[model samples]
Target: MTAPDWAESALALLVHRAGGTAAQVGSRFPLYADPDDGRWTTTGRGSWTGGFWAGLLWLRARHRAGLGAADLLAASACTARLAPWARADTATRGLILWYGTALAVADPGADALRARAARAALDAWDPRLGLVPWGAALGGERLRARADGVPGLVPLLTSAGPTGARAAGAHLRRHLELCLPGAGGRPRPSWRYDTTAARWAEDTEPGPGWTRGEAWLLLAVADALLRVGTLEGSPTRPPNDLAEAAEQLLESGEFLTGPLVPPADTRRPAGPPDTSAAAIAAVALRKLALVPAAPWAAACATRSDTVLRHLADTRLTRPTHPAGGRPGGMLLDGCYDPAGHTAPSHELIWGDFFLALALAALRGDVDLTRV
Candidate 1:
C-alpha cells in the first residue's frame, strides 16, 4: 500500500492476523510472536505487556467486522483477568486498563474497574519523593522510579475525574520535576531514589540515555501535560523544561530514523532503528501536537509522519507477517533490552500494537481522552 492506502491496508492485515491468532488461541494473552516462526506465547494478565494483544483486538474491532460473540467473550475474559489488577500488582495498570480494558469493554461494572485503577495509581504515589514508586508494597530501600512507569500511571490519575485529578496532576508534575539530569542535551533513563539513604542514583543501563527508556520518558511527560489539561478543563502552560526535554528526546529519536536527518553516524548499531520506540514517538508526537501547550508541534507532527511512513514501507514493515513468519512480522528489531539482548530482533506485541496506534492516530480515530 502507498501512503494514501497505508492505514486501510494496515487495518486489514491486523484484522486478519488478530483473527487468525484468535482462532488459534482465543482469550489467551499473546505476549510476543516469534518473527521467524510466528510462535505465540501466552502471558498472565499481570504481565507488563499482557494488555497489548487485547489492545490490538480492540483497536481493529473499531474499524472492521468479524467481531461478535467472540469479541465480547474475549473482552469479558480480559476484563475478568484484569479486574483484580485495579490495585495493580505492578505500575503498568495504565497500560492494562487503558489499552486492555477501557476501549474493549463497556459493561456497567467497568466503572468500578476505572475507580480501582485510579486508586491504584493514587496508592503508587510517594508523597516524599513526589513520584510514583515502582513495584508493589515491598519493604526495604523502597524507592524505585522508572521512566516507563510514568506512562502507565498518569492516564489513570488524570482520568480520575473531579476527585483526585488536580492532585494527580500535581503528582504527575512531580515526576516531571524529578527527571534525571541530562547528559549532552537529552534526558537519562531511570532513577533509584533511595529514600532509605536519601540519595539519588542515576539508574540508566550501561550509563545514561538508554534508547527506549528515554523515548518512554519523552512521551510520558508530554502525555501527562496534555492529559491534565483535558481533565481539569483548565489551560495548561507548557513547562519549559518538560517541553524542551521532549524536543531533545525527539532529536535522540533521530537514532530511530534510518539516517534521514543529518548527523548521519549516530554510532549505534546500524540495522533497523528501534521501530518500537519510533512507533511510540510517532503516536506520542501526534498526540502532543493536539495539545495547545505543547511546543514544536508542527515539527513533531512532521517527524511523526516521517516515522510512520518509514515504518509502513515494506523494507521495515513485514506486511505479510501473520501468515508466514520469516523473521519480519509487522515491526522488526524490537529491543526489550537493547544493551542486554533479552528481547531483540522480534515483533513485540507492544511494538505492533503501537504501530497500529500510530496509524490510528494519523487517521484521527484514536481518542486520547478515552484511550
Candidate 2:
C-alpha cells in the first residue's frame, strides 16, 4: 500500500489501542505493556514516559475530532493531570511538559502549563554545568546529564525568553560536547559530575551503545535547528553556531546509516531491538526535513518514511497476524532497560507515542515539527 494507506491503517489501529489503554490505565499513565497480552504496567504520577501517554491522547483527539468530545476531554484531563510534574525536580519536565502541552490547541490551560514548565526548567538550569542536571527526583545523580534529558528541553527553554534561549543553546551545546566526544562513534549517553574535582565523567550505565541515546540527542539537535531557523539570526537568538552544529550532526550521525530499528544496546547486538528508538529517530528525521535550507531534507524524509513503514509492517501488533491473539496497534519489541532486564521486549509507551505521531504526520493529521 501507499504511504497514506499504511499510515491511515496504523493510525486507526493505534487509536483503537489507545482507547483500550485509556480504559485500562484510567487516571494513571501507561509505562510499558506486556508484548503478549498488551497489559500495561502503570505509573500513578506520570513518570518520564507519561507525557508520551498524554501526547498520544491528544493525537487521538485530533485524529478523531469528528467522532465526539470523549477523546478531547480525555486529552485535556490528562494534560491537566500533568500539572504536578511542573514542580518536580527533573530535567524530564521537558519531556513531560513540552510534549504534554505542545499540541493542545486553543487551550489556555495547556499554554499556561507550557509557560510554567519553561520557567521551571529555566530555574533548574545551572551555569556551572551548562545544562539542567538529570535531577535527584528520578533517583539518579542530581548532577548528571543524559541524552534523554535534552530533546524537548530545547524548545521548552526557548519559550521562556532571551535568557531561556541562551540557556537552551548552552544546554544543548554542553550535552553535545560531552555526549559526542568526537566524530564517528556512538554517543556517550550520560555523564556524572565529580563534585570534589569539579569535572564531568562519562557515565557507565547508559554507555555509548544505548539505542535511544543517539536518537534523543539527534531530536534535540533537530529542535535546536528548527527553533534557530525560525529566529533568522536575531540578537536574542541562541548561539547561531548551534544551527551549524546541529546540521553537521544530523548529516553525519551513524544512527542514520545503521539498521532502521537497532538493538537496545549496540554492545549486545543479539538483544531485543528498540523500535522506540527507531520511532524517535523517524520523528527527528521528519523534523530535520522541515528545516529551511537543510541539504539532507530529502534523504531525511525518505529514511523516516522507510523506518515508519518498517515499524508498521513488522513491529506493530495486528489482530490479523498469524501469531496474534493480542490487541492490535501495540508497538512491540521495544526494549526498556535491556541491561537491567527490565521489560526487555515489551510495548513501550513512548514507542507507541512516536509511532502514532509519525503515522499522523504521514497522514497529514499533524505538523511534525510543531509537536
Candidate 3:
C-alpha cells in the first residue's frame, strides 16, 4: 500500500485508541492531571495536554476520514469549551486559533469560534513589549525564551491571519533580534530565556541538550513561513531567516540521529527524538520544498522523506524504557521531563496525533502531485 493508506489506517487506529469521539479528551490521566488550583500539570509526560494541538490533530484526522466542516466545528467547539486544561496558555490559545480558523475555513458557522480564538490570542498580547505573553500563569513569558522558541511559535503562526500574522511576525522579529545567534541574516537552532536571570540568556544553552529544542525551532520557522505565504496580493517569499534555520536543523542530525541525551545535570535522557517533532519537521520540509531553488528546499525534502519513513518503519510510538512499558504502548522517546523537575520518559498522545497529521499531509501532497 501507499503511504497514504498506511497513514489512514494509523489515524483510524489512533482515534479508536483515544476513544474516537468528538468530545475532547479529559485532562486527567496517569501522568497528567489538573491541579487543585486548576492549573494543568504533567508528571513525566511532557507537552501532552488535551489542548489545541491535539484538537487540531483530531480535526485533521476526522477531515481525512470524510468528516465535513460542520462536524469539525462541532468537534472543535467541544475542544475549545470542554477540555479541562484549555486555559489561556500559549499551547491552548494557539491550538484554539489554529484549529478554530481551520474550522472557519471549512464551516462558515465556526466564524464565531474562530473569532473567539482570535480574540483570545489577541488578548494574550502584551502591548508594552509587543509580544504575546507565554501564559497568564507564567507571568507573561514570551515563547522565544520559554521551553523552546519553536514550540511557542508553531501555534502562533498556525493560528494567526493577515493582521494577527503580521503582529506575530513583528514579535518574532524582535525575538530573533534578541535571542537568535550569529548575525540577523541566518537562523540558529536554539533560543534561551533564563528563568533564574529573568531575561534572555546570553549564551546558546540547549540545557542538558534537549534535542527537541532545535527540532521545535525548525518546525516553528517552517510554520511561520507558510503563514506568511498565505498573505494577500503580493507574492509570498520564504523568510530568509526561516530558510537559514531549516538548513541548520537538517545539518544538526547528530542530535536527531538517536535517542535524546540526558542533560549533564540529570541522570536519564529526556526520552526519544520527539516523533512529533520529526513529524512537524517533515511537514515543514515539504513546505520549504515549495521555494524555488532555495538551498534548503532539497535538504528539507530529503529530511521529510527520511523522517516519515523512520516513523513508519520504527515502533517509535511505543515506550522506550522498561519503566515506561505498560499494557498500553510505551511513550515514545524525546519528551522533556514532565514533572518540570526531571527528564520526561512516557508515551504522549499529542505526539502520536501530530505525527499522524504530518504523515497524512505528506501522503496527501504526494498524491496531489502524482495526479
Candidate 4:
C-alpha cells in the first residue's frame, strides 16, 4: 500500500483500539474515548489530544489522494468534536483551526466544524498581550513565561499565516533579546515568578544540573526556527541565527554518552541516556535539516537518527496502552512522577505521540495518512 494507505489504516486501527465508534473516530470525536475503568486518568491524555489533529490531517491528505466525499465527511465529523478544550489554548486551538479549515476546504459540509474552530482560535487569541495565550490564565503571563520563547513561536510560525507568524516572531525575538543570556552564554532553563522580587530568576544556582532545562530551550528554539523557515516558503533557507542556536545545542552533547564517564557520576550507567531528551533532540535536528546548506544539518540529522533508532529499539516507541484494552489507561512505561510521592508512572499517550511524530518525521513519513 502507499504511505497514505498505511497512515489511514494505522489511524483506523488506533481509533478502533481506543474503543471509539467508526463514525465517532472518523468524525468530530477523534480522541475522546473514556477510560476502561470509567475513571479520570492521565495516561492517554497527552499526545492523544494530538490524535484529533492527526486524524484531521490524515483525512485531508486522503481526500487529496482521491478518497470519496462520504469518507471525507466521516473524517471531518470526527475531527470536529474530538476536543472541547481546543478553545482553552492557543496551540490546540490553532491545530483544530488548521485541521478544520482543511476539512472545510475538502467538504463544505464541515462548515460547522470550521466555525467552531474559528471561535476557539479567536478565544485563544489575546489582543492586549499581542500574543495568543496557551490557556485562560490571568494575563497568560505564567503560561507565556513558562513556555519561554520556543513553544510560543510555533503556532505563530507554522499554523498561523504570514501576518500572525511575523508578528509573533517579532515579539519572541524581542523577548529573547531582553531575557536570554548573552551570545555564547547559557541562561537558566527558565525563571520563576518571584512574587517578592517581582521578577524572574534562574530556578537553580549555577551548575550542570540544568540539562533538562537547556534541552527544553534548545529544542523549542530549534523547532520555532524550523517552522519559520517553512512558513517563509523557504524551507531550504533557515535564519542563520536560528541555525547557530541549533548548532550550539548540538555541540553541547551532554546527553550523548561515550564509553567513559566521570568518576563522581559513575554510579549511574549512561548506556542509553534519557530517551525523552533524545526524542526531542531528534525532532530538533530534523527541523534544522530543513535548511539544506545549514552547516550543522548533516551532523544533527546523523545524531538525531542515532537517537531515534536507540529510542525505537529500546521499546520507547511502544504504545502507551496495551492493545485490546479499555480507554483512559496508562502504558507500562508511560508516566513519570517527579515528586516520587504519589501517582504511578505509567506509559502515557503524550509521550507516545511525540515519539511517533519524531520517528515518523525521521523516516520521511510525516504524511499523517500513514500514522
86-116: candidate 4 lDDT, tens digit per residue? 4555444443344334323355545454455
lDDT of 1 by residue, 235-301 (tens): 5675565566566566655533434212111235453346577677776777777768455778777
Clashes of each: 0, 0, 12, 19
Measured against the true structure, the TM-scores of the candidates, in listed sequence, are 0.84, 0.94, 0.67, 0.59
Which rank order by lDDT, best down to worst?
2, 1, 3, 4
Model 3: CA > 4 A from native: 1-9, 20-48, 52-74, 82-92, 99-111, 138-144, 147-161, 182-199, 202-208, 230-233, 252-273, 316-331, 334-343, 365-371
Off by over 4 Å in 4: 1-78, 89-144, 156-159, 174-189, 192-216, 227-237, 252-274, 316-345, 362-364, 367-371
* Tens-place lDDT digits, model 2, residues 313-365: 99888876555369999899898898898999999999999999888888777
- The models' CA-based lDDT, in order, is 0.62, 0.86, 0.46, 0.42
Top-lDDT candidate index: 2
lDDT of 2: 0.86
lDDT for position 360 in model 1: 65
Winner on TM-score (1 vs 3) = 1
Worst 10 residues of 4 by lDDT: 258-267
What is the alpha-carbon lDDT of model 3 when measured against the actual structure? Answer: 0.46
So what's the TM-score on candidate 4? 0.59
Candidate 2 runs further than 4 Å off: 1-3, 229-253, 320-324
Question: Top model by TM-score, which number?
Answer: 2
Q: Every model's Cα RMSD, please?
A: 4.0, 2.6, 7.1, 7.4
Q: Write candidate 3's Cα lDDT for 142-242 as tens digits.
A: 44443243343444443555666665665555555553445322234334456576555433434424444445555555556555554222345666665
lDDT assessment of candidate 1: 0.62
